[model samples]
Target: MAEKPTLRWGILATGMISSWFVADLSLDRQDAQANHVIQAIGSSSLEKGKAFVAEHLPGKSPTVYGSYEELYADPEVDIIYIGTPHSFHKQNCLDAIRHGKNVLCEKAFALTAPEACEVLDAAREKGVFIMEAMWTRFFPIVRALQQKLHEEKAIGAVHRAFCDFSFDMKIPSLGPASRLKNPALGAGTLLDIGIYSLTWTILGLEPPLGPAPARAAPEKTPKVVAAQSLDDGVDVATTIVLLYEDGRQGIATAHATVKSQRDFARIEGSEGTVIVEGDAAAVPSSFIVKKLDGEEKRYDFPRPGRGFYWEADAVALDIAAGRKENAIMPWAETLRVMEIMDETRRQGGARFPVDKD
Candidate 1:
């Protein structure tokens, strides 16, 4: 039997995303290739940290630190999971890396591409693993789709791709200082939900060029011609056209304050179309291939743990193998996606304070 390993994770925030990530840790069958244990909770308030454990991480007594710095200093923590708001990602990641801890940061990797590049460089200098938690890319269903569309050529000669990720977030009534509405906190549909639509674009439309981390900066970045409608200094809805160097085009849409039920990401080519369907378009549970000859095939991948554990497990496995970055969603991929979104926001007049920096 292969030696099963366990990785200790320190959570940086007590937010909803943090809860989801830790909850999935339990769903993982412990026997295995890798396992995750909650080592610590680093929140602004120790009381809040303890409260989070009482609720989200019940029965698992993790060290509750009143500050993130304390959590970073923990000798037992193998990796840090940064679930702080989008605005704090760069700083959170850098802090964790400076402490020599590996990291899994929840996406939008950073408020800007430069920020992403800076943090990636820091992690590289520190020689620790770092990955943007584009959790969907780790899903078996998405992996199967990628293999079919790219390797098997299930969709031949792809020409166009379309994706939409939106929901009724009710941002208008929320406090201006709230993370969801505050530009200071990197709030916007583009940086938050729009990433999902753009991720599908990169995964489905871009040439299956195989994820090769540039180590330096990426050579080619996609061109984003886009527009958006902002509400109270934040993008509420946006539309984008991604033009790839190889002449592939993707049409994507994102909405933060609108109600959308029929959300899907699909790619079309000469051979057929691959359609991804789920309540949330980002982490889909199933996919289908529709051929022009009227042949339709469907695939279903049951997500026993709400689809978050795969990425966490992947992080543990990669670390065990001594890899610094994940091939599926490499640092270059995160940087490229950030650049596109940054430019898209610039075109749409939804610039944040971070943009001026």
Candidate 2:
């Protein structure tokens, strides 16, 4: 048997996601085959970084840095995991790449496709690994669904797909004052939570065509129908129609106000329909599929922790194997999502000050 390669990881940003990731990594220590280790954590303040290391990481005593630059420069760190806010992803990733470190940046990779492209180009030139932390794509259930869709033909030629994710922020007003309401931070339901729904659409929809276009092949192009925004600069709500040349359509919606009982994706075809309950980006405990023959099937997947450990494991394996990115969350897919998001913001009139100039 091949021995697992040990990978030393540097964590950038000490936010909620970073905390969760640290806890998950620590738990991975129990597995003898797991090859990842958190070597250091960098926060805006030394106090915060030290506190995080104390509280979550305990006696491991990983180095703590007051700034990301210090973390990137740490020779012991093999890769950098970015957990900064959406607005800072591009710059954070570029810095890590410049320092010759591999990166696994959190979702909403960047506010714009152009920014995402820049990061990807930098990673390519440096010959280092870089991937969007779209953890859901690495989930067991999601992988199972992808296989089922292809093998069973449960949803034939997916004619339409609908996905929605909504949560009540309970904000009193819509203004630039609140980060949730601020456009400058790239804050919005779409970027924060809607990206999950978008993942479902992207997964169900196959890649666009190029030289070869089969008769029943997935569409070569997609066009957005409309995008709506609330009074705030952020997109409190948005509905996007992804059109395929093959006459297939994927509909996605995201809203900040009001809660959704079930945030899932429904893919319909001529033969049957599959209902993915829970956020596809964040897999739930179970899912169900309904067939045209009046039959219903259910699938359940339960894992230890918040199910984020899988992505961490994937990152460790990839870095140890000297890979540039996760095949599931490729740089191209990240760019495509960012492009769609940029267009959605433009059509909805939710422009950030940075974008204005």
Candidate 3:
């Protein structure tokens, strides 16, 4: 029998997302072949960390730490998963990388493009693996969509696309200011949900065209087209437009107050359209493809392990292979998404405390 690749994981934070991840990891363990294991959990308080472990992980006993620094220093831990809020991602990730530990950070990867770049640079210098935990990109449905777009050209020429995600958090009524509405925590609809809407755009559009034709004609460098943001101060809602060189346009919108039934996405082209129904952020259950020829195809994707094991599998495969990151959610792609979000915030006037002109 081949030896199982052992991946010792240390979790930072004990929030809702962290609980979900731990639950998924435990569920994966039922399969004897699973390679990942939780070794420790660190929270701001030792008692809280212990309670998290006791409540979430019943049988398996994992170490609990009062501070993240101790988790970073633990020799037994091979990788650390950061579940901290968006604003803390930069510092937490940097500290983990500096300690020579691989990291899997939850999205939005960081508060700003510059902060994300700093983490990328540190990962490169330290030779440590780091990845944004954009689990959707690792799912079977998303993979299938990518292949369909590239191989079948299901939506020929990719003329335009629209995606939306919204839910009513009822922030003002929820007293105590949940992180969802707290500006200090980098909370808003854009960074929280807009990132998912933007994923479709990124997947469809190729990189921007080189310098504009006119500027190059004079043998001078062209001015870079900076991204535009909504500038609302707090992004309760946001709309982003992405333009491609081939005349393709992508529209993504998100809101915290409204309830969008499908959390849908549609891609239109010269030949046909592809409609994905269900929360794109979650593992989608079904999709439909309609051709110009009046033919229709429907697809139903099976849910596996609460829709998180696929990402866990990707992490295990990459780590065991000694790879620095998953190609599916490459560091470059993550940086691009952050850049877009930063610009969106700037346009929306959604400024975090750390964002200085």
Clashes of each: 0, 0, 9
| Cα distance off (Å), candidate 1, residue 92 | 1.2
Model 3 segments beyond 4 Å from truth? 1-4, 29-34, 175-177, 206-232
Order the candidates by lDDT, highest first — what do you get? 1, 2, 3
Worst 10 residues of 1 by lDDT: 210-219
Preferred candidate (TM-score higher): 1 or 3? 1
Candidate 1 off by > 4 Å: 28-32, 207-219
Per-residue accuracy of model 2 over 125-232 as CA lDDT, tens digit each: 999999899888777887777777756667676688887777787655655565576667778877887888777786776632222123234334488775867764
What lDDT is reached at residue 201 by model 3? Answer: 57
Candidate 1: give the clashing pairs. none
lDDT of each model, Cα atoms only?
Answer: 0.86, 0.78, 0.78
Tens digits of per-residue lDDT for model 3, 110-150: 99989999999999999999999988776677767766765
Pick by TM-score: 1 or 2, better one: 1
- Give one digit per residue, the lDDT tens place, for model 1 in 1-357: 667578999999999999988898867464335777999999999999999999998778999999999999999999999999888999999999999999999999899999999999999999999999999888888778878887788878888889999988889889888888998998888888889888888778654445445443443766789999988878889899988788888988998866545438889999999888887876697888999888999898876767788888788989998999998888878888888888898899887787773
